[model samples]
Structures are given as C-alpha cells and as structure tokens.
Target: MIADSGLVDGLRPSPNFGERRGHSRPEMLIMHYTGMADGESALRWMCMERSQVSSHYLIQEDGGVVQLVCEADRAWHAGAGDWRGRDDINSRSIGIEIVNPGHEHGYRAYPPAQVASVLALGLDIVGRHAIPPENVLGHSDVAPGRKQDPGELFPWADLAAAGLGHFVRPERLSGGRFFGRGDSGEPVAAFQSMLAAYGYGIDPTGDFDERTRAVTIAFQQHFRPCKVDGIADMSTITTLYRLLGALASSPLAAQGGSRGAIRTA
Candidate 1:
C-alpha cells in the first residue's frame, strides 16, 4: 500500500483492509498499543492475513513508523464499537497501533522517541482530516468492555498538550457520593446520558450495569487517569462534565455534534 503520511519510515502492506463504508473519509483517530511481546511480532501479526487485523499505521518502540494500509481504505482494527451514536468505526476512523508490551505482557511507559513520533504523526493525521480533538480517542474509548489497549499509562495529557486529542486537568479525588455496578437512579441515568452524549455507546437506562462500569473505566483511563476503578467518583464525574463543557467551543460544535449541557449533580 502507498504510504498515506510522509512521516512513514517503512511500508508493510497488509491484506486486511477494504473500502470504507458509509463515509468517504475518516472522522476520528483511534490509538492502540500492540499487546504483544515485541514490535516485530506485532508487526508480523498485523501483516498476517489470518490475523484479520490491520491498522493504517504502526509506531515501533524505537519510533519507526510503518504504513500498513492507505488512509482511504478501511483497516480491520477497530472491531465492534460505536461512537457518537454511530457504528462501523473502522470506516470512520484511522487506527494507529503504537508498539508496546501492553497490559498482557509487561505494561510499561512509552519511550520518548516513540511518543514523539506518535505526536508528530497524530498531528499530521488530524490536521489533514480535520478530525475534531474529542474524536481522537483510545481503543478503550471505543470498545470499553472488550479492550483497553493504550491503557492508563499512555500519555494522553501530553498528546493533548501537543494539540492532538481533547483533555482537561482531571479533578482531584475526594470524599463524595459515588456510583458503581448495581446502582440505579436518576443520577446514574444522568451519568449514562452524559457518557452517551460524549460519544460512548451507552444508554440512559438508569442502571449502573456492567456496561456502565466498563464505560466508566474507559472514561477514567482516557480522562481521569489518576484513578480507574469503574466507579463514578467526584473526580471522574467532574472531569467528564468539564470535558463536555469544553466541547461547546471545539470543532465538533461546528459540525452540529456538540454534546448537550449535562448536570453533574
């Protein structure tokens, strides 16, 4: 495949891509960590047809970038998931697989050079596509219950500072009313509504079920990395509220997709 970005250091075409559906161009960027022993193994896996998985780009631990699929095609990276009430994420997003022994092997911090490459490539992709800041998200954000790659250790704040994704200073943790699985009420429904409004695939069912917990954990991993216990604490709630509030002025607002105001009480 032809390289989509000039920043690509190499090319390793994979046969696991197809034409994009429902959308002509990508509107989101999804980040992931190769959950394997090493970068080579991860690369080979993506190139293997049997694996049934491929991303548009892969950033090695040493910062080398390999383009597996052209930006115009739909790579088989994002599995079953939805964002902003839309499905077929693979058709609407560009996927970047950052090399790291993820939570399975030996979860660790991303190195400096690798992170720099990610930042540069991310900036390029988002700029070219005009992807909104809030639309750049981690795999966990799209498929909360089934996956959590590019986990909590990923430097989301750093990327946000570098003008990639949307982020805010997380609220400080403190004593307050919190909700978890099995809890159901208007507050829980409100929280679910906020999550749904922010693009997560959840419903305002008024029940903090397994899906709610998983989505909460995903939100915390991406936004409130200080804690990710799947319980909606004051910190998580306030952080989400502020993040939604910030979206009013983001590029997404111009697209008529801005989230409605949510009450955090």
Candidate 2:
C-alpha cells in the first residue's frame, strides 16, 4: 500500500477497513495510543484480520512512522463513540496510533523524539485536510466510556504551541463548589449543555449521571490535565468556559466544531 504522507517511512497494510459510509473525506484527526508492550506488536495486532482494528498511521517509540491504512479508507479504530451529535466517527476521522503502554500497562511519559515526530505528522494531516483545531482529538475524547488511549500524559500543549489543536492553560485548582455524579439541578443541566456545545455527547437532563461523569473525565483528560477526577470543579468549569470562548472567536469554529462534521481528537 502507498503511504498517504511523506512522513511515513514504510507500510504494513491492515485489512480492517472499509468505505467511509456517508462521508466524502476525513474532516477530523483522531489520536490513539497502542497500549501494548511494544510498537511492533501493536502494529502486528492491527494488521491481523482477526483483531479487526486499524489506523491510518502509527508512530513508533523511536520516532519511526508506519502507514497501516490509507487515509482515503475508513479504518476501524474508533468503535462506539459520539461527538457533537455525530456518531459515525470512523467515517469522518483519520486515525493515528501513537506507541504507548497506556494506563493499564506501564504508562509513562512520551519520548521527546517520538513526540516531535507525532507533532510533525499531526500538523501535516491537519494542514492538508484543513481539520479545525477542535477536530484534532484524543481517542478518549470521542469514546469516553469505552476507551482512554492517548491519555493525559500526551503532549497536547506542545501540539497547541505548534497550532495543531484547541488548548488553554487550565484554571488553577482550589477549594470551590463542584459537581459530580448523583448531583441534580439546573446547574447540572447547564454544565451538561456546555459540554455538549463543546462537542462532548451528553444530554442536559438536570441530573449528573455516569455518562456525564465519563464525559467529564474525558474533558479533563484533554483540557484540565492537572486533574482527571471526573469532578466538575471550578478549575474544570472555568477551563471549559474559556475554551468555548476561544472557539467562538476562532475562524474555524464558524465552519464547525469538528470542521464539517462536529466532534473529538
């Protein structure tokens, strides 16, 4: 298979892809971590037809890059997930798998060389596709309940410095009124609405449920990295509010939160 980008060093094609149903082209870039002991093993797993999972690209721990699926095809990376009311994430997104052990294994910091390569590749993809800053998202952002690959340790701030995705300095954590699961009121509904408006899939039901908590954790993983407790504390809320404001004034937000579609990283 041909590499979609010049940055790709080689190809190891995977058979776990199909036509991107309904979508004409990818408008979003989703980031994921291999969550395996080694990049080679992870690449092999995605190539196995039985694994039934594939990503357009994979960046190895040592900074090597591999193309697993062509960007023109829909890779079976994102499973059941929703963002900004759009449910067919695999159809509208280009997936890039980063090599990491993930939380379940021996989660650790990303090597600088690997991060630099990923940032370069990500910038190329977003620039080529005109993917909005908000459309560049982590897998956890799209599949909050079922997945958390490319977790908080990912260097999102560096990507933002390179002008890849939406980001803001997290508000300082402090004692304040916070919301969490089991809470119920207008404030809860309002919080849920804000999250939805920012591309998370949640309903303004006036009650904080398990789904809301999951989404909160996802939001924290992306924005409020200092804390990922799933509690809507003052810092989390303030950060979310500022991010929304930033998006409101951005040239891309006019196009859509996730560019043409609406959703995650």
Candidate 3:
C-alpha cells in the first residue's frame, strides 16, 4: 500500500485488489458512491472475500475518510468502463467511493458535509497525483449504461468550484429544439463526434442509437443536471460545445486553434 496522501483518517484494508497491470501508475481519479444504505455495509461488502469488489478509499457522510485499497493497486471499481481510448480504467485510475444509497434504493442528494469532505479530499488527491482537471470524473461518466450511483445530485458544480473536477455553467434548458432516441442523420453524427472529441466513449455514428442516448444522459447528469431524460436538447448540445471551447481555450491547445474545434454539424 502506497501512502502518498494521509488525508484518510482511517485505514481499513481490503483483499479484493491486485497489482496494476504493466506497472501502470494512476493518471486519473474516479469517484463513486457506495450505493448501499450506509458506509459500514459497503465497507463490509468490499472487505468480504466473496464480494470481490473494493475501492482505494470510502468517504462517509460525516466527513470521515477511510482507505481500503492502495494507490498502486487496481481496485475493482471501474469494471467494463472506458475513458478516452483506454479500456483498462482501473489500471490507470484511483477510485474513491462515497457513501450513498444510490439509485437502486432511492438515491438521495449527498449531505453538504459529505460534499465538502469530498471536495477537500479530492483536491488533495488530484493535486498530489498531478492529475488533469478533466481526469477527475464520476463513475457514471465512465460506465453510464451500467451505473448511476453518485447521481446528478452529487454537486459536481461545487467540486468544480473547488478545482477538483472539470465543469462549466450549463445553458438553461428551453423547449426550443431537441433530439432523442429516434433522431438520426448528420446532426446526430455531429453530436456524437463532439462527445467523442471530449473523451466520451461514443462512436461518431450518424444514427442516434441506444448507446448515444445513454452517453447523452450521462453527460447531462454530470454537466447539465437540470434534466437527465436521455434527450439531448439545445442546452445539452450548447453546453457540450462551450465545454469543448473551454478545453480548446486552455493552455494545452493554445499553440494552434486549427484542430481544436471540429464542426461535425
């Protein structure tokens, strides 16, 4: 177990992790919610021999922190998820599980204290690890189809304000124009391309398939929390464009603006 940061107040080791493949070091921070009734139950499950699941750390609702797995090891949090072009998310990321009931048993908004703690701890982790702001993502962002824990009510805006994750003010949703499940053609393809360019695991296909809908809802959940009905409205699309612009305007792509914005539409 590597002790890079000692922000975790408690240390409860779990036996569900192994060495990260290919001597991989973490470059991202993936946050999750326990999705159980309480932290103790989630901790117990993660520690059990049969569970075969664990995260590097679990933060309680009362601002308490605990470390279960090690930073150098691959925890069992991000199963079957992709980011950018990488499929082995666990191998390249550190996972932190927060305590929440999740969508299964009535997901609720995280307490203010819990959010504050997450912000602080997340800042500490990302800073120490030198992770890019965009690299700090939610579990739902990585596995949108299979997961929704740490749902839209998780206060991503607060985290962004604290410089833990990447976010932009969402354009308010209006009933002007929108696209949904049955929508298709160049517009859909353009949308997909934008999403893919922003590191979402979506193919730039012109057809608005189920996968595209899932990814849209996931984007809304994190970026535009006003609504998450799997429909990409003007607000969602504009927010995506603005976010892309924000990324382009960053120092990383300031050298040449020719390739930053691709108008697939």
Best by TM-score: 1
Candidate 1 stretches greater than 4 Å from native:
249-265
Spell out the clash pairs found in candidate 3. none
Error of 3 at 196 (Å): 0.5
lDDT for each of the candidates? 0.90, 0.87, 0.83
lDDT of 3 by residue, 1-265 (tens): 5555667788889999988987457888998989888999999999997998999999999989889898888989889889887888888899999999888877988988888888888888888778888888888888878887678898988888878788999998787556789878777777777787777899977788899999998899899998889987888988887787777344324323322232233
Best by lDDT: 1
Can you give the lDDT of residue 24 in candidate 3? 57
Q: How many times do residue backbones clash in model 1?
A: 0
TM-score on alpha carbons, each prediction? 0.94, 0.93, 0.92
- The C-alpha stretches of model 2 lying farther than 4 A from their native spots are 248-265
Instruction: Give the better candidate number (2 or 3) by TM-score.
Output: 2
Report the C-alpha lDDT of model 2 over 113-222, residue by residue, as the tens digit: 89988999999999888898998999999998789879899989888988889998889999867888899876777677778888998888978999999999999998
Answer with 1 or 2, whichever has the higher TM-score: 1
**Which residue pairs come into collision in candidate 2?**
30-265, 136-265, 137-265, 138-265
- Give me candidate 1's TM-score against the actual structure: 0.94
